[model samples]
Target: MFLTRAPFRALSRQFQQSVRCLCDKKDKDVKTTVWPPENKEKRLEDWKVIDSTELKPPPAENPITRTHRILKDDILRLKKYIPGLDGRTTRQNATMWKHTLFGEGEGFPEEEFFPSHCDIVIIGGGAIGSSIAYYLKERAREGLRVVVLEQDKTYEKASTTLSVGGLRQQFSLEENILMSLYASDFLRNIKHYLGDHVNVNFVPHGYLFLATEEGAEQLTQNSTLQNRLGAKNILLTPKKLKDRFPWLNVNDIALGCFGLEKEGWFDPWSLLMGFKHKAQSLGAEYIDGEAVNFEFEQNEHIQIQGVPSGEYNSTNNLIVKLNTGEVKRITFATCIVAAGAWSGHLAKLLKIGSGPGILSVPLPVEPRKRYVYTIKSQGQNQPLFNSPLTIDPKSTTYFRCDGLGGNFLCGRSPSLEDEPSTENLDVDYSYFDEMIWPHLAHRVPAFENAKVCSAWSGYYEFNTFDENGIVGLHPYYHNIYFATGFSGHGIQQSPAVGRAISEMILHGEFTTLDLSRLGFDRLMVAEPMLEQNIV
Candidate 1:
């Protein structure tokens, strides 16, 4: 009982503090339930009752936002009851609230239901989809009915929520630098775009990328490209790194590139929420369901069977099948495939790109798992004072403050071995101990005794072709535009990519920025737009 009560009260106090920050819910009745017993059956009984009635609204607010908060509350409460398990279990339980929220006896507003049709439908309503919706509606002249289809209503499994939220313009390629530069500007003026009421908590402490002697030339070249694109990057020597960041162990570091101004981390969930709420306010309808299949109209279908040479025409119409057993036949002229890791699978449904010797370019995007660890630094000797996002390029290790004092976030670069089951959202605690901790401790010796509070795994939409984003319309399916295959950098690149896609939809080409280098033509011709700075 002591074990259960202690954690519950602590969590409840933290919850109340956090809730005070949310202005919309401050006036409303939002209940935080706490159970006395540690039994699963008793906890479930209480949870069911609270979830059914606690969120009943009097004062109007965003339903999805309200639901997310409530589910998060329940996750913390339930996590306290489960005993003798690892902290990662709490993270996993917290991530699966969609299963409980949208289950029996829980439902959303009628307007929030999966619509039958719309003017524009964007799949995968994560950060990218939401951003596109926001931009499209912001620039729309004729009130275009934009709809976003997201399978995870709570966004518990989405990479946007799980990401470390580091934004930087330091890149080996010119296109990446330009995209990140646009993102930096957008993030700075985010309030003007996302409304004054919302705050994303952008921390521009800057990013420090440390490279060994072997990687110094490429790092220098990257810094040059970044500088050419108007980015404020300073090449720091080992002594400079030590002076700037006293806690850094720069013994093996040959050279470091630091973004002085617009490179840092932020609250990813807040940015996503801002985009979602703004898009919703601008009349973009968001649906909750998985996109299972695609239906192409006969006019849109190709005559590969009859002709000696299978010449492609265009897709007259597309029908998207939802997991909830609803089929939507789109009468709209355009559909944006921004499904991230699932984009390749979605493209396969249209039969645009599949096997060998096909004229159409294959979106070689696949899910690669990456782990994020949350740790609390205890000792006085290990003080991380206002540290920027520090990365060891050779070791593929990175760490930064988690906004909460004494707590820090860290992760290691995903190698080829990390590529496993796409459905696996479970964290590998062993990986932190075996792979991550060793390298991180070597880089920052203080991390040797750091306590891992919690951890979770996220999937990157890794593009095997170039490891860069694939944007623009498909050559075969002109109606279908792509904003997917951003690999791991989707959250930081969402603003620029979203704006570019919106421009393409509104003005028929990229007006604001020329994103042609990330087009489908590059993928088709096997021209890889390589981005060497990947972490």
Candidate 2:
């Protein structure tokens, strides 16, 4: 019965094809054509109907189309073995299209399935972590898989969002100076890297660091170093400072280091979003979860310099707790601890500080709460629109104009003895009135009558050792790396730090900047990369 039905099925299909052709011909014949009678060949060619069974040579495939076909075939093959692979790929493609057609929306739809494994896993999804993801995926494209685990998607307490968005190249250390210079370049040409729709709202007024008579020599030396390293800045006398900024009171000031170019503040939130959107568009997966713990495997084959012969344990899996309260494990070949202020705590999960030998040295990064207050000084002698972000070395107070209104943002990092509790993000208005107002009013007499309008507090990924970023592999776990301990300059240095981390991961060494001095090895050697300009 099957053999008899085979020929009948073929004949039925042929009959249907013939009927379809006839109906199509009749429909075409009834439609009126605008072509002249002389263009008979063109009309026939335009309305030609080929046979269903006829074989025609395929058209030439462009590079883009060929690449897409290869990717589609690979996805199709993997879909059978990998659950939800096809759906994830489709959603990612849709997200790319959405971002390209209409600028970034709320975000890509929340992913339903968490990835079981990835090539690289970043602990934080703030500016630093997102920037690292962006650089890695951008360089490796589909060849690399990067997953960023962020505890909070809203970024309410993220330091990158709450920062004052200051960018300056005035630093005593060469590494910090170079990083700031590169950040300025990166932000200036941000449209080339992160789509044209992304705007940071950069305000290029520059930074002014005031110094007392006791700190004048150190300030001059810093200014000299900054100028020698391609930073456009000038060492201004108190008379020159008063001339440039009429609102400033330079009575107690001995010297002022003023940035002439490539220094300013931009919208940190926008910059963070740009990095995140660009990273996601480049195939980086951002998981909404916190890294609760780490799982280690005892590997007999692996050996470290200081670790005992048989006691070496390798860590490649992270236990994460999702926002929905589901705990899962994600295995990765490499892990980067860019968790900002929380990096030290995350490191402790892996026995970084508790373990014997080199692991006993803890990651000194921790959250230091600093308050920022916005004040309005409406009366006479208000700071001009172009007033630089001014810092007083004596009191550690800094203030910068906030847009066109008669408003300014001022803050002072509390002394170590007077450090506030990091239990919450509550703003202490009294700290600003007592510690900050006295310094700000003394620096700029216009702020003497300023009334506090609003206040906020954020964590500075403070490094207790030297207050500088630690960017390198861990001493014990070769697979783990760190890009934390940036003190208060992480956001501005994120672009350079991300590229540096990617370089080290992909190329196995520092490529662009020789940040060897700023590595975890420094902690082991008891040598700190101290920067004279901490603010």
Candidate 3:
């Protein structure tokens, strides 16, 4: 059974000093029930449950400023478990977690009868939702509370979890490129403050983009902008790209650029968990409920009540509820709608057309179906695990290794007409045979003869406008904030989006970066940031 090591105690003490991290046990008597089987037989007291806000006493001798690397490494090695882990994804993610500050937990705790409520209510616990919770919790006060309301417990349909999980800076606008650049840095050093428990892997495998004639012109221009902003990894020639990714066929008559070091994918949920665990430890709450509708209390809040009130008068409050015959009232002083595809569906209640209000932009971020197929490699020589995250910008398709034997591959919908209905949540494999396979074959001939592998389908928060996200405040709903319309890039954008949303609510304006450009005012002027790198 896994026992608390010396490093965990040191880490727990560190978190405790930063904020008052409390475990919500009834009687201050913690019980041991659902501890990971790996940690079986150990008593909860022996497990070292330290308050998150508590910190370790400083060492008297050689002073360590922050983020001690070795002790941090040990914290990650201890909390290792994967339920329903697809064989190809388990090891890489866990290993990545060991080095990176990728967050943990499957969105919801598996333990039963959990409570949920907080002063700030965030809808949609995907990347953006959870990220907002992180910032909100990070700046918590004595009694000021924050909570996240998520629909799916397993995140089977979260756009953040389902998307390609890519982050790049090849944007036509300087703001977009710079924001992503800062986000990349934030991702790299997440474990420094969030938790030493996990390293949170953000592999610098690099991003490859191909250019058709028009796309080439766009890439050439954006590459200059990316470079001016210090995105040093931009590639201008096809030869350079071909040399970097030998597997890529760059015969097309245009240009190509790769974010040589600044762009790549990472462990999304671990990032989610890193924020979530720290947030919870610092007194942020998470509720597993589908935020179906809202009550616009004029300038105040949407009410939430029921779901077994907490004895602490402020614990276990579920903000979102299915459309049951009964009505429960839960209120939030400030409410942020980070709901992805479902944001539009929920916003229909107030008829608030997507203008600006954080992640909710005029972006046509509607749900569209996409399929992911898994392909086993030829052998160890062609190991999928070592393969980098590859994208064929020509058709907006990409493939990357899940872990060992197979790769997780997907591409955009053939056309808006071919997209699945918003009501449909089922996986469609036919899209692969009719559209995806042919396009994949053209990009990587190795895949041309590659046999069909098992496939699954999920939704894309299709940004109907330019492929960029819709963030910031709405024109009419000043008090209400929304975080929808990420198109397919929400996961990478979640961390930044979360912090921005929190800053907007508590401080009245974004201090980190001015998100005013992403607001509803843009829609009023009919000016939108059209992203060229949508895949």
Best by lDDT: 2
Residue pair clashes in candidate 1? none
Residue 41 lDDT, candidate 1, scale 0-100: 21
Q: Write the per-residue lDDT of candidate 1 for residues 1-535, one digit (tens) a residue.
A: 0011123333453344335335433223322233343322211112111122223324665655754665576565554336334344654544433322323232222332333335688988889999999899888723466878786768777889988888999888887888889988888888899877667788888888999999999899989878888899899999998887777788989999988988998888988888887786656777765554454434424544332344444442344444454444443457899988778777876666753344345678877788899987665446464788888777678888887578888887667766545556878888888877888777777777888999988888888887889898877665788898888899999999999999988898888789999998887677888778888
lDDT of each: 0.72, 0.79, 0.58
Candidate 1: 10-residue stretch with minimal lDDT: 42-51
- Listed per candidate, the RMSD to the true structure in angstroms reads 15.3, 18.8, 13.9
- Model 2: residues with Cα > 4 Å off, grouped in runs: 1-96, 99-108
TM-score of model 3 relative to the true fold?
Answer: 0.70
RMSD of 1: 15.3
Collision count for each candidate, in order:
0, 0, 51
Model 2, span 389-450: residue lDDT tens: 98888887898889897788989878889899877788988898788888888877878898
Clashes of 1: 0
lDDT of 1: 0.72
lDDT of 2: 0.79
